[model samples]
Target: MSVSFRLGILGAVGVLAAGLAHAGWLWFAWVAPAGALDPGSAAASSWMPLLVQGSWTFVLAAAVGWQLQRSGQPLQQSLALLRQQVQALEQGRFVVVEDPPAAEALPLARSLNAAVRRLQSAIEEAPGQGAQALRRTARRDAATGLDSRFTFIARLTERLADRGGAQTALLALRLLPVQPGLAPDPRALAAAAEMLHLFSRRVPGAFVGRLCESDLALCLPAHDLVAESAHSLIAALGSGPERLHCVVGCADHLGGVSLGGALAQLDLATAEAEAAGVGALVCRTSHREEATPQEEGALRRQIVEALRANAMELAAFPVVDAQGDLLHLECPMRLRLSPGQPLAPAQAWLPVAMRYRLTTQIELAGIEMALAASARDGLSRCVHVAAESLSAAGFVSAVRSRLQATPQAAALLWIEIAEVSLERLPPRLRNAGTVWQRCGARVGIEHAGAALLSLVRLSELELDYVKVASDFVRGVAEHAVQRERVQGLVAFVHEMGARVIAEGVDEQADLDALWALGFDGATGRLAGRQGTAEALVAPGSDAAACRDQAMSPA
Candidate 1:
């Protein structure tokens, strides 16, 4: 029987027992009176005893009810404690609640204790197999098993947390054809996971995780050999006709910090990799000298004020044709804290801005600046789009609207999306290329050649231009093989109906070599010195005046 029902029966029994005792007392009282006195007196005494006995029975029933009511309090308390413990567990905390010894509460207490034990066991076991499972889950592009995005973030996080004397490095392995033909089959993801698991086991003290659907992160904890490690890891993926590329970023002496801080640093390092255009990009987060509290505080304050006042500036570097005619301008956003202070690159403020969820505002402002510049007669503009902004449906729509409203300048505006960012685009915004194109705006992929695996597939996307990475063009004149390779790339792009622009052209020889290589345009330190907006607006006039003054006999 249920506990309540049993209690009810016990209470009823108690009442019955009291009633019986009361009846016995009445019988004794009545019998004694009858034997010792007259019939009338005995009858009256018997009636009085019966009345007293009935009153006692009522008192016993009340006592039983009171006892039952008091017992309910402990049950309520036990339930409340159970709820609190469950809440704690849900929040990823382990909790042990001591249950009362009452018989009614023992079952619930035992159940809770059992659950806590199981959870603790799971926690203890996670480092071994659990970590493996998480790696498998995140390793493959949810669709293709190439690599998932989460795997990258996790591996980078762990690497950043490592403090062993050995050097730590992060390698981002992105599969070519970042977007596989269709939704990746689960079977494919499983296969990819197995392959990666096997691959990871070969590397000692290495942890692999997913950073996104298409990015896999590999962390090597005890290696001073970043370059060798990257080459080995890539080689293990096997020699194939198709390129299997890995972008690596490494740091030595990465110390302990909050997870958020580590992620922030990882994001910066990744950006550096993308910008650097290496087959593998490696960065050391630990500097020879640490930033003092005062310095960090000042930087933080300056960034805050810049964000608050929307005072950041966007600067444009011209991408000129072989004959030195401006084909378009590569507009990289720069931030200036105050007059006379040097401007900082987007990487400097971008991470914190993202942490603060201010990417959209910053991107929008950049778009405005680019459009304004393009609207000036005889100028074309290419501006970068952050992956996060592109992932948002609303932001895409807003950008489309803005482009449409500026149709006269839209064709001149080339929206450049990085390969990494492109991989993260949601389905709703996957057709962003089509959307932007329909609005009379052109699109291009920046940091090209870095992710050679994705190059051919992305090429098939039919972008308007491809900005060959600066690193690839660093010393094109000095290396025959590099020059021929660049020439071949320019030819291939031209055949695809897309223009090729070489970035990071810092030397006169690099610019001259690019011209001979059939590159349609070039942009970098060597193209021309960067100047203020007003100076750029009158490039011809400004240069003529300077030349005239310099040539004047002195």
Candidate 2:
């Protein structure tokens, strides 16, 4: 109990003992002796001794009890301090007591401090771990480990967004022997996934995914031997015990074709394959007359020569902050094969570059060009690095050495990897981002939000900023739901300790809405341009109209 109460109890016990001793002495030495002898002698001799012994005994016991209680006070105080620290920890405050009141609690305090440190470390690594888990559970088929339909579609759309769909080849496969209205057999699906996974290994940079209940698809660089891969896939399907039949259709992404248009072409090819019969394969070329082998070789040689000659120019665009101040210049490479030929945007030639395995070399060259321009212009510039290049061997080291060589230019550089690619190489990106940052450059993800859950782990990538894809930002000005999403995304990115930027701000109204929603910066036709005299949410504008419509339901 308390020191005061314990001491009081001890004092009472001492007083009782002292009283008992006094009573005994009185009976034997005072009362009994006085009755048999002279009263005055007995009283005079016993009274003084009795008073001295009782007083000394009571005082001595009380003094010793008080000392013991005082000695325990430090320990009691130390326990209270520990309790406070533990409460703080429970409340998410990692406070520790320095110099605990008593040495008895020193070891416990050290242990508590160590626990706090460990928890902090786990929290720091949690985002990346959580991101990976999300990709597995949310983005992939549970059994197949292939991207979910929605995730696959998003990635396809992103890839196709580039010019000529980056010359991608779409291979669609339909498993046969399906009962009408019934789902495809899981065994067949799993077997198909396994076959596709193995076949993909033979095709570099090939991506496979389950697109429908009985249909699966793979996309790769168009220059790959699509017909041969399809044949191999069909043969593998027939080798199984069930002799499962499959129809394979291959379509090359043609320039100027929309995603829907490309899918339509793929569907036509699949229909043709099915009509040809089960286990049949059909191929659709981009042109009515496919290029000959010599023509293909000539184009490849030209690209190689162009790369060797370093015949590309960079087109810089401004990404600006909320106040319309320039944040950086996005310098995308524009290839010019000959002095007479006009510059071609990356979309026009990237597919060819990818086909020739020249992306790594081309991207590296672009980085060098951007850095040189940054040095000369003294302006901050951003360069987009494709996922292919990032995974290419020696790419990171080459960029690191180049950045190190031009420290000043590196400091002014911003390197971005696509969001779709980010999902594929977080660990590599994590290391690369740190190296780039240390070399005075910043790394980030562009075209983000394809996989919403993956954004939660942005901190794991250690990026400087995240650029939200235009699809999400397109009509946020007129859609209340979109505005809410953008706002939440901005807050989430901020919590992850990275700025959020809006890409493809085509309309002034959209840009205004983004600015109000707390976007840190943005790029597009409308960004970096002066705002109109009217308020951001002007009357009769889409933003105001949307607000009114949302409140109308009330």
Candidate 3:
């Protein structure tokens, strides 16, 4: 029976017992003597039994009420404890509780504790998963699923550093027209990415990475020869349907060489590829002498100091239209001096800076120089960004902050990321582009008519202009097919709400051809040889007065 019913029954039983006892006592009194039935004695005898039974019933009710209150206390306490445990688990803390009430709360505590254990185990596994995710993130271009700049550099450096104990080589593929202006199609970029993926799969141990939007690096390990490996890679890339015409540079370590030396060799190979208009070119550098530990240490120190002091020189090339009107200047960076002497192209110092993880610093210096130059000249300027630097989340903020500090210079500042860098434009960069546009600055794409037609995707960026590769524009005059192709490209770019600038124009015919082809502007030897800021402007302009009078002649 329920507790209330049981208590009622017990109460009834107690009353019955008391009644029986009282009856017995009365019977005894009657049987005793007539004197026992006296008035005072009878009164006491009748009231005593009844009062005792009432007191017993009241005591039983009080005991039952107390027991009920005590039972509820355990339930309430258990619930409070469970809430606390769940809160702890949500906060990622897993600790065991002791001495829980065995009967009512033990099962709950065990279940909760088990859940906590599972949570702890999952939490423990998270770091490993996170680490793997970071590695994957580092290896692929964030935007296009192509290899990242860092992974590519590391693989190239490793291959170059490995002395020919086993044949090691690097294929540096530079998409022609590194500068902005050729409106690239997004489909071309995807096609290039697919082609690279296919090529990598065909060549064993060949790791492909996007060094920049305009460059791709492939490292071939265990190759029988460096030249052969480069050729094979080029052939594979050329055979692709996309027909990405790449300037391939190949380099190998003939003997023990520092990672820096290996990169230098790769740089040389890239130059060779640029010189040759083929799908690929290979240059092998045999280490002449083994670098001593002291030499390596000294080189490292030099690099550190150079990067810290921003000891680099910046040169600006004027971007002029077909009318010979100066529109903007493109700043390409060059290292002033290294441990040995001035490094030639960025390729020489860049790999080392990247290997030592100093690209961010270098990028900062480049931006600072470009901004300062823009401020002084009061002309719009375009600064190049490495693919790897673009991947860094803070890079945009750094550039924006620097630009903000120079209010007068912000409007004229234009930042151009290589086509390859676009493969991994971080969200921060994409957002930064909007911020930059709002600040009266424009964003442009460099090396437009090269591999990875997917550059068309950039149309969504609403960029100010697209610069086509000079080579594509150079001989258009001689080839009607080429001229028509460029015309169509310019038309497509215009449709995207962006203008086109042609590069590498060295002849009036070339300029005339581009003008006819509908290019917005042109730059190269024909536009004007590299000259001072003054020479870039019209004769009466302030910049023109600063031109070296002796060089210009009256």
Which wins on lDDT, candidate 1 or candidate 3? 3
Instruction: Name model 2 segments beyond 4 Å from true.
Output: 1-291, 531-554
RMSD each, Å: 19.7, 21.0, 21.6
Identify the runs in model 3 with alpha carbons over 4 angstroms from their true place. Answer: 1-298, 338-344, 426-428, 506-508, 530-554
Worst 10 residues of 2 by lDDT: 545-554
- Pitting candidate 1 against candidate 2, the one with the higher lDDT is 2
Give the alpha carbon lDDT tens digit for every residue of 427-472 in model 3. Answer: 4465457776766678877555543123333545777888765434
Model 2 pairs whose backbones collide: none
Could you tell me the lDDT of residue 17 within candidate 1? 51
lDDT of 3: 0.58
Q: Is candidate 2 or candidate 3 better by lDDT?
A: 2
Candidate with maximal TM-score = 2
Give the clash count for each candidate. 20, 0, 34
lDDT of each: 0.56, 0.66, 0.58
Model 1, which residues run further than 4 Å from truth? 1-305, 336-343, 376-378, 426-428, 529-554
